[model samples]
Target: MRCAQFRTALSARLDGEPSGLPEVRLDKHVARCTGCRDWLARAQRLRAQVRTGTADGPSPEWSARLLVRLGEDRTGEQPPGPR
Candidate 1:
């Protein structure tokens, strides 16, 4: 498989989202391509970090603030004119 093709499916492969033929192809490509192998390693590390909570997790307050900001941006409002 071409590097671009393998790259496009790399994330899905790491996430176990590929299936059958694509999965096999990606697997073989990863095994043979050092570049793809590095990408897979980085993806796996990032996924593990996210799962283990070492990475930042969005808090409820942050989500609320982000939603409020998004709403304001969408409506083109000035957030109550900054008090």
Candidate 2:
């Protein structure tokens, strides 16, 4: 498989999304292609960080403010923060 196709499938597999390639094909490509192997490693690391709650996200305060804004919109009330 081409590097681009392999990379795309690698990402999809990591994301638990549907992939067209067989599992054996994906594994074989990663084993033979150093570049694809590195890409898979990086993707796995990032996925691990996300699963461990270390991925970047809005601060608690920011998330609270966003929730308040969403609630206000739903209830047709003015939100507290500057728009």
TM-score of each model, paired residue for residue: 0.55, 0.63
Report lDDT per candidate: 0.74, 0.86
For model 2, the run of ten residues with the poorest summed lDDT: 67-76
Model 2 per-residue lDDT tens digits across residues 3-64: 99989998999888976799999999899999999999989999999999998899987876
Candidate 1, 1-83: lDDT as tens digits: 46877776887666778633466777888899999899878888889998898776798778767867766643456466554
Tell how far residue 20 is off in model 2, in angstroms.
Answer: 0.8
**Candidate 1, backbone clash total:** 0
Mind sharing the TM-score for model 1?
A: 0.55
Judged by whole-model lDDT over C-alpha atoms, candidate 1 comes out at 0.74
Error (Å) of candidate 1 at residue 81 is: 12
